[model samples]
Structures are given as C-alpha cells and as structure tokens.
Target: MKSATQDKRVFTEQETSHYIGMSRSFLRQSRMEGLRKNRTQAPPFIKIGRAVRYLKEDLDQWLDSHRKMHQLPHEGGAHV
Candidate 1:
C-alpha cells in the first residue's frame, strides 16, 4: 500500500525531463515558450528560487493542451 504522502506527484526538473523523454534544456525551452505564449492559464506550476518544479497533473494537462491531432502527412494523401 502507498501512503498518501508518497503517492503525491511532485517532480524536479530532471525528473520531469526524464518523465517526458526530453532533455533538461528542452524542458527549459518549453517553459520559455509557455511563458512567451502566456500559458499561465494552460497549466499551473511552482517556481522556487532558481529551481522550477512541476506537478504530474499539471504537466499532463499542459501536454494535452499542446498535443496535435489529425495532422495529415505532407504527401497530401488520405489514409484509408
């Protein structure tokens, strides 16, 4: 059995990068882009001094918001 405290999903920058299969720099880039695009309304995050942490739920929601669906191939052919 998992304790409620242990079950809480809080991750550091490195953990988040690993979880998302992206480099730490890429995560920073994404964070910058999010800031540039005023994505505060998109997801919630915590900024502690020089370190930035993210909740799994917020990251999941952010990914869902940025997800691209129904993108057709450049060949311009429909998949039947």
Candidate 2:
C-alpha cells in the first residue's frame, strides 16, 4: 500500500497564488478569515508545520462557485 504522504498532494504558497492569479497576501487573508461559511468549520486543508497548503480540487470548486458570467454587447442582443 502507498504511504499517506505519497497519496497526499501539496502545493507551495507561491505556486497556489500563481495558479489562482492572486497575491500571496490575499490567500493568507482568506485563510485568516477562517473560511467562515461551512457549518462544520469550513473546508479541510493540509498544514505542514507553519506552512499551509490547499488542495487543487478545493480551490477549483471555490473558484467555480465565485465565477461570474457577463453577457457580451451583441451576443445577448441588448438594446442600448
């Protein structure tokens, strides 16, 4: 059987920030806010000593939930 560490994936703060196109400070702020929404103490995350790592799947879901779709000027045929 594979070890737990082998099964688990980890990403550095910089890597995650670059992937999400956000500043490292912003990511730290979000985490500091306690991810306040879930009933059972927000989403699960991995922490390596003092450094924190986030799962790609969790980040993707968060992005999808916060995504916004705007209609184009002519695509939706809006009268102006």
Best by TM-score: 1
Off by over 4 Å in 2: 1-9, 35-44, 70-80
What is the per-residue lDDT of model 1 for residues 1-80, given as tens digits with 9 covering 90 to 100? 85453355988887776666668777777667765554333245589898788898887877788777987466866668
Query: Number of the top candidate by lDDT?
Result: 1
lDDT of 1 at 21: 64
Return model 2's CA RMSD, one decimal: 7.8
lDDT of 2 by residue, 6-76 (tens): 34456567767766677887777666677566522223357888878878677667667656697545765
How much does each candidate deviate from the true structure in C-alpha RMSD? 5.0, 7.8
| Superposition error at 8 for model 1 (Å) | 4.6
TM, every model: 0.59, 0.58
